[model samples]
Target chain A: MSRKKGFWRSSVWSLSLLAVLAGCGSNAASDSNGAAGGTATNAAGSDSEKEPVVLKLTTWNPISQTVVDKFQEKYPYITIEHDKVYDQFREIIRTRIVSKSDMDMLWLFPNQVAEFSKEDVLMDITGSPWLDNYLEAAVKLGTVDGKTYGVPYNSQPIVMFYNKTLFGELGLEIPQTWDELLAVSEQIKGSGTAPMVIGSKDGWATQFITTAQFGLYQHDNPDVFAQVASGEKKWTDPEFSTYFDGMKELADKGYLLENSVGLSYDQVAQVFKEGKAAMWPMGEWGYSENFDADFSAFELGAFPIPVNRGDQPLVTSLVSDNLLVGVSWSKHQEEIKLFMEFVADPEIAKIWSDETKQAVTVKGGTSETYSPLASSLQPLVDASEAQIFPSMTSSIEPVMFPIFQQILLKQDVDTSKLLEQLQAAQNKDI
Target chain B: MKFMNFRNYIMFILPALLIYLLFFAGPIFSGLYYGFTDWNGFSFKADWVGLENFREAFRDPLLLTALKNMLILSVVVIVLQHSFSILLAVLLDQKLKGIVWMRAVIFFPVILNTVVIGYVWSYMYAPMVGFLPKFFDAIGLHGLAALDWLGDPSLAIYAIALVMVWQYTGYSMMIYLAGLQSVSGEIYEAASIDGAGPWNKFWRVTLPLLIPSVIVNTVLSVIGCMKMFEHVFIMTQGGPANSTQTFGIMIYQYAFKTSQMGYGTAMAMILSVMILAVTYVQIKLLSRMEVAN
Candidate 1:
């Protein structure tokens, strides 16, 4: 009995020590990785004899692995390691950063620029030479407090994607106002086609419509949010009331797709691209991403969401999707900077543009099959008729997003109460 | 022998003690401590914010709604999932044609991964090309055709719950089957000799004997449904107007999306206490269900 107890005690101590050792061993491995990465990467600055370096990049979205290989070929010493973390990127990445994980770079949404830049987590790269290569608006998105913490990757806009062939067949012109848009939807429904194709099953998809209005009105009244903040203007006031009323009118008249709430985004896009729907309200990238020649023989065009303000320039909702950010305390800042410069290169930007069918923010980057409707998108930006949405009040969006879905679910919702909730949430965040 | 008894007990428990200290106790205590601080999930550090996060949570309409949802899921799953599972298990226990196949079919969904089940159900619940709407339409139920299973707030949570029931009913059934098998066949023979009907035999003999299974199933489902995340995360993501929001989803939303780590941890701590209290109450209440075999 004494021998057996002794053996068990010995085993317990040894096993626990082994677990401790295993944890320490992992830390040691990462330390070694950080060391190797630092030396070879910093050596790149002098452009002299160098050793192999690994640059770790974490992204929530897919970027072609081949693109990393291409970058490696250009800089033989630096090896690019990409980690694709989906669904739980925010949680995982925040934890990683806090635990001092040695990731060289990461992708971020535009709204995160301010959140991260406020901390020591993100390195300031305001002087990156490649910043000049991107459009001013795109560059502006990666800036917080006049400091550039990220480099712009891509921009997309929410718009009305209409089938040109179907429009011609129905003798319909692009609607200039909210009433016209609804009248056209009713007409399209009368002609036995789904009028407006949307998938409200995903609340985010429904918010595209709401977000579009938010953007359009911001272009007209930039102080609207400030007014609400000061309690001088309610959301039930003209700015939002008109938008909500127009939306409710559409729902009341059955101008929406018959089974919109049951369809997924991809499925509804498929229906619209196949010319089964008269108008598909989607992101500008929809034409490039969702249009399949096998499903339709029609040409597609785009227009902005009409705010029904006669003679006011129509505001298109534009948003910068991906911004490349670097860790502030990385030893290989030079190497991280080099990688960002390469990604901002028009050649690399063009490759991303061609693959994802999304617009690259780099000025010289161009895709072969760019839509003519998207061609004048720059002029709209210059005219101040383009608004970067979801960024207007990103602090409040987390609280308001669910309410947006609720408004869609119950059309008769009291807008005053909803605005009060918004006001309360905004105050709490403040 | 007396001298070695102390050593033997210590040796036996040391490994488990170490594991419990490192994994379970470490996280729970750390989370509880952080609940008093204002940690923004990431950054330099946290500051003390005692009782503030808890106060905020109590006032939060969304969190309250999520708590309500947790209770609804708990009650529905405990009652419906276990009773239905026991009934099916009893029927399957009888020697019938294709009994093995029926058991296999019922238990098959349990073995499949949550993601596969979630995605498959998501497609089935979809309209037009999906199965549910088509079946309803074929049956001449025009109103039921194209029912927005996951979209309408009034119906979305129940729809999600039905999927949960489908996935877990087999699990409870297997437990009941095991309990049913444990009962002596001689007892049934004795009941037959007493001139008892099938229903009477089941009620008087089988039910009392099956109390253990009922207790386990009820406890398991109550806790499982309270911690429900995967299917709800994949299917609706607590959407179609926050109708399907649960404490688990709220924790993720606050911790990650909103980046309020301290508050999220506080919410998690509150949720842990709630689960503990509920489970204890449940076990005590369900202990009355057990009968001496």
Candidate 2:
């Protein structure tokens, strides 16, 4: 063959192969895109007669699969496809809009709802029947500009989880004073168990400590948010430094699990679960998971994270559960409302409360079906003293985590300089 | 092969050229445009604010901090990675007993995924049950061991850069080995007859002959360090006060986490320009060296 003809023939073959490969990709995408505009309604309806509707719900929380199964059972016409996007929930759901994706529902916590609300991405579930059943705090979180956008699921109070067996063995009571807590930690460290397990490697886990510690001073100063808004209260204050100082003290005394910086949240949980550490600092959200584990000799208990002295008011930080947001762009609003209504039913809410080991906002959600660890904090939560977590999640978390890591690692960190840097980091306009 | 008609030539190259333009140039220009807007990533309705995002990025202290960290990572990685690779390539060029074992051992980390390598080093550098601290104390070198390899701001960048060096040195050694083998045996024989010793021959002959490989390896290492993110993300997360943060991590943080699409795009433009400038200089310098030698 002539050179020109050979080149032409080869190019055609190569281009054809590329075309075929590209076709395959497009075909696969369209097949998976069959998640919307398929909700069937029974206009000639009786109580039990309806066609099946597929609703896709994306979540970051590791929701129990059985809750979804039960929902499907109640509305036999509805099939819920649950996608656990994990840490990428926000990015994925947000981008789903660009693709004109068929996502119906999503779970968002705290700031995410507010962020998404700015874009008008979520449906305004105003006067949603489920709203009345929810706690006012949860309703407020999911609301922006007087319109409700989400339904609250469960709320968890962050606390210090202790091994009762270990505490009893060391002849220690739950220390109500910072000095007593230090002494207890010292004694525990001397006995060879690491006083606490806090994994700073993930950086986000350090916020658990910050939020919990901030609770020590939160009850007396419930209006700290106003101070923060007015720029009157800086994280570098001596009062705040006491928390950092406590972390430094733990690191200096080798009371922290020596390699906690390298461990992840789950790894530290395991260390505490295996009775290698005296306490695990975390929220009650993990109560069911941790308590279900093989702790042969010990029972899990919790207490308020102490502040300074015994006389000072003791408190804990309660972080409400993230709200379930409905996508405004979805074609399945009926199915979305149906699923949420099922969730708000008292029996179903109680089941969610039991499974998540967190207090549900449904009026009769708290029916005393909590694990011993969660029950310990229920009274404090009911008393309304457990204020919202004071730590700044957005502006401060990125910079503060590192400073907290250094303090907990016994490094010579200048809180003054670091807090200044954090303030500078927050000062950047997006 | 034969020459084609001009129309056929255009048709043949059109597919590949269009693919390149559609994927590569399209995104680059789009990102440049996004840099001038106030986009929150989630919203496509961007309010165009001319140069505001760039100005904000310029004033941001963390960007400067991350830029400094990227430079240090690039310098340290380029030096150690190339030196160690060259030494290994030269030594392994000599056929000795157990050469396969030594090469395999050195190249083992190269085959492992970077995520695995990062996690392994994290565990090794951990204060408890970590190999470094315990091994150091065992060898009476306790001062050299750190309790938290990633928690110390002063040491975190260097520590992460060294991990990159450890992982890629073997790959560079393989490239240098290929370059070394291409040099004829006659050149070394001629050097020996001229009364040149091994050290002198290496500096005079082996080094000069390996210019092509040096250029390739240096370019790769420079690009790798300039965009270093995964290791920092997996290990320190640019922490102990963002000491180990890099340009790539900053782009991801602003774009994805912070939802500041315009700010991230501005930083991304800066990083792309910086990479382009560095690569251009490197090509120019290497071409000069190639011509000089």
Candidate 3:
């Protein structure tokens, strides 16, 4: 009888706890509106009159945390809590957006910015005085339907990291053209180093390089994108054949790692860092480590990939480390503007650039004193002809990423098949 | 005399009946109702979609791949697992020394969480940087001869299946051991007096008595294998081109990832039908074997 009474008492307690939790949740939503309004009211105050407004930021780069900490010290009244989620960063941000939960600031890719900007979930920063400080291509990527959605910070373009030691042994200069690249591969193979360590396991690395190879069109033909977007030119055009044949040539010649199809980028990177390969095709993010690591003791040099017609020399890349800060449909306009002005500071960009060993997209933020690899990468930046938007963040991303994945798996994969799949996916949304 | 007491029997069964109705039957019937409507798991309203979600699931290639994986997994686990368990039980029943300790060792993997086991094995198969491949190299295998086990599509599913077999064989052994205990010692003694060989005695006497345990083990293994999710998910995430994906993974993709709750329910309904059909057939076959004996 006592045990039965105890069970009844425990059940009543659980029921009350559930009721209390439900009440707290509803109350918290109301409190959030008051808090956001209060923050807007106090934005113009002196350092002491302002209560600390702590905003939660989710970003990808490790260096962004350093940038946030420095920003916090300068403006003590505006505290920022930053967290980094590496693998599933996009998934977390997407979930929050769909749920209409809180997110004050976030980092976005070209595709993500394009998608969200279209959806009107971002603050329009275009025509602002600070917009003049950013690169034209970077600004264009952040703009969708005549409204700027994000402040572009850095850009990472695909470059070939060739072994200078192997080049010296084979008496070859760094390849200036695709023909020379293949020629150098044969020379390196004869000299006893693996020609290149291309890992296609995760599938994204292949897309980055292949997209770079196709960047020449943006400069040569301004109408190409408008045409492609309108579905005028097919993916099966002759240019695609050249790209597919080139990828197949590399695979057939065994220039890539034998187990690359089965290995991830991280594993392949270890092999490159360990000096088992002559060259690695990766972005500038790995530059600081390449220069500092004792194992990568050989001379490291980067060169812009050559176009088919070498004279045109068009270079393109996706925006890197872009911060897309927006007023939530729930936030007051004044609060978002103040936050945007704070993130746009040159000092913040400087601190971020120094820590991340990346270039700042803003004027007066690029530094020459960082390292040799960053200095040599100036041409790739200068050649920023275009930024091919990612499709996943937009209606197209879920469709495009998988189709591109199949293309990278084998060269024989038909381009027509991918185009058809995309057309079908677009029809579904319609 | 019995009719008056039978009134008391109704009182005895009433509490359990109420609990089952509340916990199991109520939710199951509710799920059937919700399965026909488009619900995102939250919201005061749900739109009815009729049989459209089910038709889409039937047409999806990913869902088809998942179904194939489930069938393959069920067959592999039910056959290989039962054979190994019975073999182990027979060896232990020979009255060997340290038999008590041996039984405990055999049952060790059965108690471990499948997620933990999957992760440990994946690291062990981590190709370039993993212990197994390094050990193989140390023992003198060179180049591509040292296989990348989990990364290769052809071998990835088998590696997961092998892990499942190792985990459940001990469980099946324990059930067989219990059944072995009930087989009269007098039958074995009588077989020996009739000059029956050891193999003959196992086939004629022991095998007949172990039939019931076989049925139980098969049903359990099949049901468990058909619902296999956590281990394969943690280890592979259906990589190397969706080679290890199961029906449960597909259901999760529709429900949470894609936010298609109604479609997920439709898939779950199909799964229920498949499980029921497969189980009914097995039980019927097992009963027929018992009747023949």
Candidate 4:
């Protein structure tokens, strides 16, 4: 009886061990399959026996996905994957570029393109026949040291976005000059309607409005300002005070909302939506979401930011937010350029522009169908003489951004203090 | 039988040791090495930068601001969280109806994700739309109270700390409650028999016994607050000027945002050192109090 019991016990233990091994084997296979499945599902253009050419595009905007989807329908053999990452996409792409990883087609702004070109990371696209298609100013923005590094896909001119209802209630006219704009703001403020709302909370939003005011003068003499930045001219020149003091004077006069220092642009936009503010300085795309009936209460209009000392109105715009097809380290250069040319075709451009409600850079597309807000912004686009402004981030020399933020926040920061700080920052090396 | 004993020991300890080696010790050692190189985090190649990254960290203005904010936040959250928690635990220790339900309600915030808690509090602090400020306005206390809780530089850090206190006070309270229950009722009974008042019994008997609990709670609070990152990032992104920026945000921006990977890693190393030093000081002080008690 004892022998039989021991034999049964040994058999039971062996069976359990076999079961455990089987379980472990299956689990390991399942985990491997899970990781493989993720890659397989995301693999582009693997629809049939033929593997399609895959192109990857990265942007912080989700709208890029819509553009990619439209492009993919026309070229079923080519798959476009748009990677949307907020706040971290630029860093990730920069690291990949520096590391020589497979990065194809990035939506880099003009300033960023300039900085990257300086670092020898961007491809020179100047000789491409596609250069004839874009507006000259748009083309110029993408060029650094006379070499084209990217394609201009979209333009967002910093126009004066005003509330028609508030303007009418306050019995005010659209300001045509810097002094007129300030006078109207004062009048509107007297009527207890917030004359202007610029959200300084994000700090960058403040830069947008302040940059536009600076543009009125800067665009007239880009060479002089560019020289100042290059240290050929003093940054403390009185023109610098004229630029900084304009924003300071507005803030000191309480032309902005009481809580302007703390409110975000979204919150400031809400004030306009709620009919609390008379005007907001923003880009053309700011009103894109007003398609919802709830936000249609206010009529939107864009005017060139009132001229300070120039006959022409100049606007600060980044090159349009569009996808640029860069040759990936792994991709065949000829095939990538061919794909980019196909997407830039006028017919395809027409479809994209009509659907997205933004201008397309293709030479022979219809410009008549733009939204009402886009229509008003056309004059600023046509009269836009300047190529690009110094992006506080892209140019590493001066971290002018934080200096700008400090000026906006400290209301009492003296001009001399500002110039000393800017000069010091501007001299710092990357 | 000797071989079987060896196999049993391996079966018991091998998995845990392997996990600890892979997850804990491995990454820390890797991070330390990376701190010395100009590695962009994706490539096989990197340049040796010596102590250049450290030199940059010392010069970064934003890093200094972030360090200051982190230090202030750590001190405020640790002290306030423990004090409120002990008070609540003491109150709940007294026998009362619905005390169990009250305890659960208090503990609810502790179980919540920091991200959710941070966002919900941001809405509550939202100037025009937030209910908190609006409620104050309704009560005719607008001038005295309707400050933009997260927007104003002077007030933003306090707002972040208040949310942290709300979330973790319940956790600290539970620890104190457990410590309270462990103290014998016999001592309290004897004090009552000797005609000692309730306050006198709490001061002489309960307070001394709770010393160990206070030490545990204080140390944990200090460590957790020192490493705070997620809530601050989600709430303000260190905005309105770098007012709410902390050491974690500074390190993350340098590492990821600016592509100064080496510099960022160096900042992170400094932060870890700060946390270690603060924790050591706290433990030393608390241990002294423990010995005295």
lDDT of 1 by residue, A1-430 (tens): 6798767778877687758844752453355336535645566454446656688889876775666878888788788888889766766877777666768789877656667777767878987788999877677777777888886587777778777777788899877777678778877888898777667666556666666776666666765654554567665565565545555566667777765665667767766665667787777767666766454467767777775456666677776767898876566677787788887888887887766666677887856544555564444444446666545333366656667666555457776677666666565444
Q: For model 3, what is the alpha-carbon lDDT of residue B162?
A: 79
The alpha-carbon RMSD over the true interface for every model, in angstroms, is: 2.8, 4.1, 5.9, 6.7
Ranking by TM-score: 1, 2, 4, 3
Q: Which one wins by TM-score: 1 or 2?
A: 1
> How do all models score by TM-score?
0.89, 0.84, 0.79, 0.82
lDDT digits (tens) for residues B1-293 of candidate 3 = 48546645654565566556656897699788778987644333579988887888789777777777777777888789888998899888868889999999999998898878977776676666666778878878766336766666667677788788988999999999999989999999999999999999889988888999988988888877777777776666665556666777667655554445677788888888888998999999998997787
Which candidate tops TM-score? 1
The residue-by-residue lDDT of candidate 4 on B85-165, one tens digit each, is: 888998999899999999999999988888888777866776666678778888989863558777777888888888888
User: What's the C-alpha lDDT at position A66 in model 1?
Assistant: 60
TM-score of chain B of each: 0.92, 0.92, 0.90, 0.93
The best-first sequence of candidates by DockQ reads: 1, 4, 2, 3
In candidate 3 chain A, what residue range of length 10 has the lowest lDDT sum?
Answer: A389-398
Which portions of model 2 show Cα errors greater than 4 Å? A1-51, A98-100, A177-197, A213-263, A270-277, A285-292, A296-300, A308-313, A355-359, A366-372, A375-384, A388-393, A409-430, B1-4, B94-105, B134-146
Indicate whether candidate 3 or candidate 4 has the larger lDDT.
Answer: 4
Q: Which pairs clash in model 1?
A: none
lDDT of each: 0.75, 0.74, 0.66, 0.67
